[model samples]
Target: MLTTLSRIVKSGWLNFWRNRWLSSSAISIMGLTIFVTTSLLLINVLTNSLVQILRDKIDISVYFNLETTEEQILETRKSLIDLEEVESVEYVSQEEALEKFEEKHQDNQLLMQSIQELDDNPLEASLNIKAGTASQYEQIVDFLNGSQYKEIIDKINYRQNQAVIARLSSITAVLQRSGVVVSIILALMAVLITFNTIRLAIYSSREEINVMKLVGAGHWHIRGPFIVEGAFYGLVAAVIVLIIFYPVLWLLSPKMTAFLPGSDLFYFFRINFWQILLLQIAVGVSLGVASSLVAIRRYLRD
Candidate 1:
């Protein structure tokens, strides 16, 4: 088994380097496929991150009545937290809410003067509720309405902002689905291109392959080398992708962060480095080996 494996691998390696121009052309095509695939993956990642940042910013702010006690708000928070669909329920004291509102309007001299004249905080204490999904906001609102603390509740913005939330959620869903469709179509195109390339390579070797069969070489003995060659194309492409991915990200990230502060794409890439590498390798290797096998079999049949 070891001897046969070594021979197969050796033949594959030789085929790759011996036909240096052909090998380079094959690798270049394979690299294009990898480049497209990786580009799609990165776009998806950035889209998801941006959408999530937007969604997290938009949440249900449940306000308590002016007379509502701190204890009552804390109690409501506990109830919100117990729900399975709730991601988080953050409590903001009335004073803190007032401070935030003022800070936002501080640059408006008229607004600052008006607030100073009021001599009292008009903002109510609140629980900012985020659910596992936008669809679950209604359930959270219902829970708040039915809770024992409902009497102290002032208002929940879920009703007023529902339309905006629904529209954003729909947009996000459409984008995600579109990305998957595009990725799949490109992947199929890549596979076909690779299959045709390997098929041509096999056709070029048909004369040698026929002589081997007459000398009593088995099907696998002829087939194995081509498969290995395909895999090597994938391996080299994957390596090239890795070589270029990080530096490209390093260059692009600062620009992206400048466009969207706290997007932190560089940190995100580092955090998910292993996952990204594995995904690219899986795509490259699978495309390369599968296309090669299919091409060689078709060639043998012909």
Candidate 2:
């Protein structure tokens, strides 16, 4: 078995080397396909991370009337925290809100003058409520409005920002749907390209294959070399893709971070290095093997 395996490997390598242009052509196609698929996967992951970050930044601040006591607000906070969808609820006192406003506007002389003209701090104490998802924000708002503490609540600021949240929700939905459709199409294209490339390679060796069969060569003996050849193409393509992708990501990481503040593309790439490597290898090997199996099946039956 070992001797037969060695011969098959040698024959596959010899065939690949002998037909340099054909092998290179197949490898190039595989490389391009893998590159596109890898890039899409990376983009999808990064987009998801960014969306979560944005969602985290978004929350509904419920301001209470000046007459509302700290104890009443704390009770309201406790109620909000009890909700299943609520991730967190924070109570901001009137004094804390005033301090925050002063800190924010200290650099602006005009804003500072306007604040000084007021007799007292006009800001209200509030509870900032965050939900696990955008969809849950509405439920949080509903809970706040219907609760016994609703009379003390002056305003829910989420209504003011509803338009922005709606737009983001629509955009995320479209992106998710589009990603699935595009991925499916790309996968189909990759499979077809691989199948055709393997078929062409096999056609070139049709006479040799026929001679082997005439000599009563076993199916495994006839199929093993082709499988190995396909795998070789896949492995080479995967390597080429990684070689190109790593540097390309390195070059673009800074630019990507500029557009997406706090996002470190290079860091994310590094973190997912092994997964990406495995994906490339899987794509290459699967394409190569499946294509070869498909092309050889008809001949084997004959």
Candidate 3:
């Protein structure tokens, strides 16, 4: 069994190396496919990061009435925290709010003097509510409005931020759907291309295959070499693509980071090195092996 397997591998390696131009053509196409698919995956990650940054910036601030006690506000905050949709709720006392306001307008002398003249803190204590997703904010606002403690709430700012949150929600939904559709279409195209390439290689070796069949070579003996050749193509292609990605990402990372702050392409690549490597290998090998199987099955049928 070991001897037969070694011969199969040797034959496959020779088959790959013997047809240099054809093998190169196959490898190039496979590499391009892997590169594009991997790129799309990175883009999806970057987009999600940007969306999270925006989501972080957006939250509904619920202000309490002056008569509302700290204990009451704490209870309301606890209730908000219990909601499944709520990611977090932060409580800011009136004094903290006043301090933030003053710091924000400190450069303006008139505003500073006006705020200091007030005998009591005009700023209200508030609960800053962050939801799991932009769409969930509306539900949270609804919950707050209908809660038994609603009378103590001075205002919920969701109405003012509704348009922005709605737009973000729409964008997120569209991106997710579009990413899946694009990924499927690209994968199908890659498989077809690889299958055709393998079929061509088989065609070039038709006479050899016929001679082997005439000698009563078993199906495994006949098919094993081609499968090995296909897997070799995938391995080489994955290596070439990974090498190409290093310089490309290094060059693009700074620019991408500049455009989208925290979305550093190279940094992401480095952090996810093993995952990306495995993913590319998995995709490439699966495409190559599956395509080879289908292509050879057709020839065998004939």
Candidate 4:
């Protein structure tokens, strides 16, 4: 079995190098396919990360009446945390809220003057609620409104922030869906190109193939070399892409971080290195082997 396998591999290598131009063309196309596939996967990961970041950053602030005390707010915060959908609830006292507002507006002379003229801290004591998902915010608001302490809750800022949340969720959802569709279309085109390239390469060797068949060579023996060649194309392409991909990732990490404040593309890439390599191999080998098999089957049918 080992000897047969070795012969098959040797024959595949010879077949690959014999038609240098055709094999090179196939390898190049397969390389591009792997490249595109890997890039799309990264974009998909980043899209998910961006969506999650936006969700994590956006939360609803529940402002209370002036009469509401810090203890009451803290009590409400405790209840909010007990809810399954609530990821966290932060209580901000009126004094602290006012300080934050003043600090934020310190650069504006008019706003600072207006704030300074106030007899007391005008900001309301509040609880900021962060839910597990975009869809759960409404449920949290409903809970706050109907709770035993509802009378103390002056307002939940859901109305003011709902549009922004919905818009961000919608955009991210659209981006994720569109990315999948585009990736599929591009991958199909790549596969089609591969299939056709191998088919044409096989067509040129039809006479040799027919002569071999006349010698009563079994189907496996006849088809083994082409299959091996196809796998080789995928294998080599994957290696070439990895060599190019890692360095490119290292170079782009800093720039990506600057463009996106919370993103660490390099870290993600590094952590997922083995997964990425395996994915490349799976895609490359599948594309190559499938294309070769289909092409050979067609030629055999004649």
User: How large is the C-alpha RMSD of every model relative to the true structure?
Assistant: 2.7, 2.1, 1.3, 2.6
In model 4, the worst 10-residue window by lDDT is 293-302
Q: List the residue pairs that clash in candidate 1.
A: none
Across 1-302, the per-residue lDDT of candidate 1 in tens digits comes to 89998999999899988988888777778887888888887778777877787778779898899999999889888877989989998899989998899889989999889888996788899999998877788888888899787899988998899998888777777877888899899977876787788778778888888887789888888888888888888888878887888898899999998876668677877998888778777777777788877777755663
Candidate 2: C-alpha lDDT: 0.86
Comparison by lDDT, 3 against 4, better one: 3
| Candidate 1 accuracy as TM-score | 0.87
Best by TM-score: 3
2 or 3, greater by lDDT:
3
- Candidate 3 local lDDT, residue 190: 76
Candidate 1 residue 185 Cα shift, in angstroms, is 2.0
Q: Which candidate leads in lDDT?
A: 3
Misplaced by over 4 Å in model 4 are 69-71, 106-121
Better of 3 and 4 by TM-score: 3
Candidate 2, which segments miss by more than 4 Å at Cα? 107-121
Cα lDDT for residue 119, candidate 1: 69
Q: Which stretches of candidate 1 lie over 4 Å from their true place?
A: 106-121, 266-279, 299-302
Evaluated against the true structure, the overall lDDT of model 1 is 0.83
lDDT of 4 by residue, 53-165 (tens): 78887899999999987788888888889999999888888888988998888899998998889898888888888888777888988888888888998888899999987
Give the worst 10-residue stretch by lDDT in candidate 1: 293-302
Estimate, for each residue in 208-234, the C-alpha lDDT of model 3 and write its tens digit.
Answer: 777888898887788889888888888
Cα misplacement distance, residue 124 of candidate 2 (Å): 1.3
